[model samples]
Target chain A: MTMDLLDDLNRAIIAALQENPSRTNKDIGKKLRVSEPTVATRIRALEDAKVLRVMMQSDMRAMGRPLLALVDINVEGRPPEDVATELAALDACTSVSIPMSNPDIFCNVNAVDGEDLQRFVDDHLSKIEGIVSYEISTALEVVKLDPRFGKLRGE
Target chain B: MRLDEVDREIVALLKEDARISNRETARRLGISDTLVRKRLRRLSESGLAKITAVTDYVAMGHTTTALVRVVSAPKVAREVVEEMAKFEQISFAALTTGRFNIVLLLSARSRREVADIIHKHLRSWSGVHMVETLELVETVKHRLDVALVVRDK
Candidate 1:
């Protein structure tokens, strides 16, 4: 109801969602003693600010998903944008980015099976025009996986 | 979204232990278990966050871990990422600001395996200009900081 009430609630909501993105506002509101409308309003603001996004913590392994792959490419003449576009089109491509360098780009993708790693290499990486070379590394274990761009740590 | 004193308390409790249950959460916050459950559900579904099990990678078979930074041509960079995504050994990748354009998180059984990967996948690549590697020695702490929590007190 009050703007201060809204801000405090919003902070709590951000804290909650950051811990468990799957939580519902009703549950959040019930904990806050406020209407669900209040919870929803503040959530919209956080989302509009591009501070948060919702995604499934999917167990791709259950569906026989392959390892998480990271690839770096060296380009001779081709543009990173074109390479990014092609990579984004891949069935396995989860995310792609072109860094501020001549040809280096980073990508994360899901494979159907571990063997698909090679198919991904032969089919996609090799197909890019001017792809002088590419490096493929499969994740055997993920130690630290985080999405936060810059984490502010303080007392 | 307006949190009250109780809600702040809830955040404090969860920050201490994410595995805390609804009943315990309610008890700590002095709210009904139904309310605690309700709040947790709201927080998770809103994409604010989710409670999931995190494992120590070193406990597994992976004996080595490293970050790879690559420099390449524009055309090659995209292809490099797409192919990298398909690997069975890499779990993380990001484009960052620095001398190197791309960064990768990798795990392998031995130095030989890593060398093999570099030779077969990265070293032989024509587009790749450089690869800088850094091994992860340890993870001190990784998690979110609840804004409402007073840590110094």
Candidate 2:
């Protein structure tokens, strides 16, 4: 949290985790010339300060399902709180949010398998009272996605 | 990264295969080696991108994956996110604006495990307004599974 805490070793640890949130603290420390305990402590401190979050990175393609659905919903006059409440109830709606200003809501629904996706459309998102229309940009390709947080250090 | 046509193409290639050498990428893009090196430095300096080898969960013997949506009192969202992160397959959680307050991208060894996690863990929490989930039926391209369309000069 302090500027002085942002050392090269810490930055390296952050970078390694940014690439793979599932990596071990030992591995991160090995790369950064710090002890495992030190890495663990720093990571704890970082997490406590709300600086870093971790997640396992899974390759969805290994599953036999087809299509990475990028469902963008265009909304108007819908209270965001109300819309969020309804959208989160659907099965296929994995990630639902408003990323940009133009469109009020954006949902990342992963429909790799199951009838749940269609059911989700019928049950959750469409049922939302304020939703006007939505578009599905089925991922032609997933170009890039990486962790947004990093350790900030002055050059 | 202030990517010109050439740099975007290079990034697209790297996104697909991070192992490509500078010389190889330069030759393939018909750009000089110096230009390739210079551009790569600029991209890194700008904090615009990063490249890393991703993992496949199925290869590791895990079987089921699901995304769980959570809505709760504002005070408890962080608590929920923390609880989700402690799980092995609950890999990604984001606080977003929409119909849902918090969404988690999770994985598990079996369908039953997902059920157990939700029933035993999530279902009991207080201030939790709703719990809805969708199991991943298939995965085509993961987080970085596609190439960004690059314009050619």
Candidate 3:
């Protein structure tokens, strides 16, 4: 659906839930001044359209994967898609993307500590054939991480 | 908090369907509803886990999503990132050690807004040395299964 079709009410409902995902349909309706069924229907439609998803997320630090390394890989002999698929299959790899710019592959990897991260690079990443060169950036601190991408207006 | 087997099971169920009722979770796991509720409360209260909504930015009309790597002057990367984090368009920001001192993931309504953020705000920052943006073409994988990454305690 286009941006114009999202309408104010739909955006409001999305914003409310993005702020607090646990909010019930009845509570959302009360806050948005709509009926409970309306809120439910809107949410269902959004979900059906693959526009929104609600799921459980955990803090990486709290979950024991305290180290996050952002890796950029340049591919040569093989398709970047194949390399990305291999990277995504690794247990530590959380996200993998092909970029429009340089650096053929980009991925987010989690490890328990520095040692684990190094071992992963040495054991798993080193085995990938197409990767000509790669850069690993260890995140020192996560300044801000708001997962509510739907709340475009900024809270 | 270290999650035991039961806790992992509960989390796994929630990962599949965050809106599942407590009773349904208990039934599926063959555990008491009260136990499910208590574990969920503990998980949430401890700040370890949460049920939240996420969206496909492109589907939500955010046509531009890019990963920006920023190099900042000595002893100023953290400060620069702190300021960048306040922008509404930036969803993720971090200080790092490597080719770039800072990395950010931002979604914008258009490419112009992305350019505005890079040139107007990031370039204008006193400490920012250089900015390299890699616009995402396709997301091969995006999974948030904490259970997959959780370590044994």
Who wins the DockQ comparison? 3
Q: Per-residue lDDT tens digits of candidate 1, residues B1-153?
A: 444566556655664345456787787667899888777666555444344322223322355655677777767766675576456566555444346656665667676776777779876769989887755433222222311111112
For model 1 the local lDDT of residue A97 reads 53
* Local distance difference test values of all predictions, in order: 0.57, 0.58, 0.81
Lowest lDDT 10-residue stretch of candidate 3 chain B: B144-153
Q: For model 3, what is the error of residue B116's alpha carbon versus the real structure, in angstroms, after optimal superposition?
A: 1.9
Query: Model 2, which residues run further than 4 Å from truth?
Result: A1-155, B82-91, B112-126, B140-143, B146-153
Taking candidate 1, what TM-score does its chain B reach relative to the real chain B? 0.63
For model 3, the superposed segments whose C-alpha errors exceed 4 Å read A1-8, A149-155, B145-153
Worst 10 residues of 1 chain A by lDDT: A146-155
Please give me the DockQ of candidate 1 compared with the native complex. Answer: 0.04
Candidate ranking under DockQ, highest first, comes to: 3, 1, 2
Which DockQ values do the candidates obtain, in the order shown? 0.04, 0.03, 0.51
Query: Compared to the true structure, candidate 3 yields what TM-score?
Result: 0.88
Q: State which candidate has the highest lDDT.
A: 3
Candidate 1 segments whose C-alpha is farther than 4 A from its true place? A1-9, A22-27, A30-35, A45-51, A112-115, A144-155, B1-153
Residue pairs with backbone overlap in model 3? none
Each prediction's fraction of true contacts recovered: 0.02, 0.01, 0.74
How does chain A of candidate 1 score by TM-score against the true chain A?
0.69
